[model samples]
Target: MIETIYFAGGCFWGVEGYFQRIPGVVKTEVGYANGETENPTYEEVCYRNTGHSEAVKVDYDEDKILLIELLNKYYQIIDPYSLNKQGNDIGTQYRTGIYTSNDTQMKIAKNFLNKKQQKTDRKIQIEVKPIKNFCRAEEYHQNYLEKNPNGYCHINLNEANQYSKSHLTPIQYEVTQNNGTELPNTGKYNDFDNPGLYVDIVSGEPLFLSTDKFQSNCGWPAFSKPVEKLNEKIDTSAGMIRTEVRSRKADSHLGHVFNDGPGGSTRYCINSAALKFIPYDQLEKEGYGKYKKILASNF
Candidate 1:
């Protein structure tokens, strides 16, 4: 199911870019929300007393992401204590807010605020109001970051990518974030041989292929190679100068690479909690059709 929410955090350019990186997020549109005037233009909202705040409407799939998780994600980038401004932008238009169209969203926003209040003594300055009025911003403001990669963004895109994958199962979290290794022969993918893709559990970044998977009796899912190089990194953090692998977008902790496999190929002994398998039949619908051919020939 698809759901919509609007977030007024600093500039819509950066806010929209941050949410769009999330896997379940379908699309984002920059706009002016909860304004006083009828369909105020960008300049009017900025210069004139239109009482409008720059915001972005996000559309996402509920099955892939939760509203509560999205709310927490929203809080990570903005300063809740700041008033009528965010980042370097100083104006009423840049004020932080959560304008919801429904009562359920209203409740979510309030609950989020209340929990945050319990943690800190400072009062949250964010506005939580029903959607009074909204107008889509100029075409130039929509998807601004995608058009200009080097554009100014208050939230770091690299860190935002990791935060985008915050909705994690407990085991997934322990294994991916804490460097806790799953016991040998206890993982789900250890002996499973099927045509599909293994993706990072946290960030959904594609990592390895079933075709390259080989049983080395290592008691873990062993792959001779990675499907793509961008999904990993080399690390030497743990005493042994081992080639540590990480998800490129999220920089998530995946398994390591070793050279003790057949054909001089490397072995990637990954933990089951660190991955989510996408079977061949569901690849295309899941936006991984480009790799369907990888499962064409039976091994």
Candidate 2:
């Protein structure tokens, strides 16, 4: 079935760009929704306070694009916690929102929010409202990127695989490109219970060892810290969030950093997508002999 979802997250220009490139999204259009005006102009929405949010309408096949996945990708593009602005665009027109057509979408959006709430203690200001009205944006706004590639956009894809500096397997590319997390409790070293090394999936650079790993029960791989100096940290204060863990070298979204570690120390509960584990036995074979010291001593 053809599925439709309305996403409003700051300006709709960059947000529309992201969905357009996604594999399953059939079409995307910049528009206005949930507003109290008729055929509001850009200037009207911007300065006149027509109450219309700059929104994007996404059309996709259900078999191709899952609503939940789209929502997640949407979160990646916009600041979910930001109240009334995205990037330099300020005012209510740029608020983060999701306008659904039915109960199924309502449930999906709510469940996704719930998952975020469970993962982090942040207050979610992303609105989940019913589809009131959708007005197509002007002709100049449609397919803005294809027509104008150099147009300004605040959203960026900081690729982790870019730091690999080498070609990787398709699976590695999937993990790195899609920000895919590994399947927890199913990896080869998930329960090895021995000194091991976690390497960058694309670059094979040694990152963490078993000594640095802690059980966070996050269902993916969990690490208390990096081995040392392998990953650079990111200051996510721009979005009003405190801090996030991103690979400095590869620019991969490893995961979030939290103060709620098993102990008092911070936990870098990373996604398996950001790592490849090499046990002690395969350390030398994997060219990670430098990390063998982790096996000799426990930190």
Per-residue lDDT of candidate 2, residues 14-73 (tens digit): 777666655456568899999897788888888888888989998876864589878877
- Highest-scoring model, lDDT: 1
Q: Which stretches of candidate 2 lie over 4 Å from their true place?
A: 157-299
Q: Candidate 1 — worst ten consecutive residues by lDDT sum?
A: 157-166
Model 1 ranges off by over 4 Å: 2-6, 11-59, 75-77, 87-93, 97-170, 231-234, 259-261, 284-290, 293-299
lDDT per residue as tens, model 1, 223-297: 887777744455667666777776653456778888888977678878888888999999887767777876776
Worst 10 residues of 2 by lDDT: 157-166
| Per-candidate TM-score against the hidden true structure | 0.62, 0.54
Q: Cα lDDT of model 1 overall?
A: 0.81
Who wins the TM-score comparison?
1
| Residue pairs in candidate 1 whose N, alpha carbon or C atoms collide under 3 angstroms | 235-244
